[model samples]
Target: MRSGSASSEFSRGLIDRSGYASEKFAEGYDRHRLSPPPAVLKILTLVAQAERPRLVVDLGAGTGLSTRVWAGYAEQIVGIEANARMLKWARRVTQEPNIRYVQAFASNTGLCAGSADLVTCAQAFHWMEPAAVLREAGRILRSGGVFAAYDYDVPPAIHPEIDPAFAVHFAARRRARERLGLQAGSATWPKEQHLERIRESGLFCSAREIVCHGFQEVDAVRVTGLAESLGGPRTIFGEAAPEVEETFVHLREAAERVLANRSWPMVVSYRIRLGVK
Candidate 1:
């Protein structure tokens, strides 16, 4: 295992700079975020040719939502996280003995070299320094190990009207963040470039992308909860702009009207960028 300063070029001090280190944000994230689709685990495990992985590492594992899903699939699971508040919640809720949380940056996890059979970044690759994180992933993955970064499309497919309203809220949140000069908790990258980063890292023998969808039954609360989990409206950065709140209200109203008091099924599209070492 690499240790000390040579372990990573990315600065450890910048871990939680993405403005999502607050207690409220972590709570919202854990409560509302959907777990990674089951196909992601099966695909990565298949590509790695491992029926049951010995070790799996989850990067930027906020609140263990992504990490805990691997408990039955791997012999050991390590969730690497940097935010103290998030880690606290993750530890409190997790019950699997095979799963453990480590407070560490994704690019500098102090895990053994070439030790992981699979490494994943769920809904979190964009907040990392891509090149550095990929290098660390390669270093920790044994030959033939798989690296996957996946994120679900937000807002999901609730209702035609409600979905567009959610988009309005999304745009409003981005505009607010820009106006407030607030950035994510780390150096952010575009999620679309995940496959490119993996292939360009020169560590993977093969790389590809897979798209799949999962369905979940949701109510108005979950709809709003999904929006709130993005750390908007009431984030550590303080209250969002009036327009942001207004747009969110519109989304909520739409959700309430469209779904009424009943739960409806929604489709969550997931994109998985995979690499095999």
Candidate 2:
């Protein structure tokens, strides 16, 4: 595994720079690339019954992880992103003959009307204004097309005590933010309530939910990588700050301590919520 600073071309000191978080986040984003839930493919399989997608659009395609997942199914896939750095990063590392990245916000993709067979947003819907994004999705999707948005929250758990340990660890981070007079990041709409919002958008019919809970066995280093990769703590405290760097070490230590007592493999559990259109 490469160290976080392996890409010296991208400065480690600029994580909070305005309008460039994605680029800043892009530097180390691949080091902690996300794995979507198994249900994601299952949902897409259901969508295949309607018609195997021809053109797919991936909104907020950070580093193109989810976009790559769609590549095999679609002849053409476009990844839309608001951040230039992230777009460049995705194009560089996730390039496929069928995949391309465009600079655009989720709310206004500038795509031709009814051009897409499917739309996907993963781990990024919370960063958007869902109503506007849904409206835009409604515009670009063909009549029978599907729009799916999904996210997984909370650090990967290493069994019974890891989640509790992480709660305490992050709460302390929040308190530190309070001490600095920096506001904590607000919670995004809960997965349950978001269903109602999706239904009310009047975009597409038959709104549905797919929930997945799974665990991955990991070590202390993997835990630390996951912690450092999240943009929240890095953006809030600034990754270059000594305190923020210290928190990563401490978070890893906390995980190690919590998992030592369990004979079971150190497992990180994640819950994924997928909203279908």
Best by lDDT: 1
Native RMSD of candidate 2 (Å): 7.4
Give the per-residue lDDT of model 2 (tens digit) for 155-232. 555656566655555665656556665432224344545667678887776776666554455655556566666544
Query: What are the models' TM-scores?
Result: 0.91, 0.76
Q: Where does the lowest 10-residue lDDT sum fall in candidate 1?
A: 1-10
Under the 3 Å rule for N, CA and C atoms, how many clashes does model 2 have?
2
Give per-residue CA lDDT, model 1, range 142-246, as digits (tens): 999999999888668888989999998987777776787665432256778899989999989999999988888889998898888774334533554778778
Which numbered prediction scores highest in TM-score against the true structure?
A: 1
Off by over 4 Å in 2: 1-24, 47-51, 173-192, 214-217, 233-235, 238-247, 256-277
Model 1 TM-score, 2 decimals:
0.91
Q: What are the RMSDs of all candidates, in order?
A: 2.7, 7.4
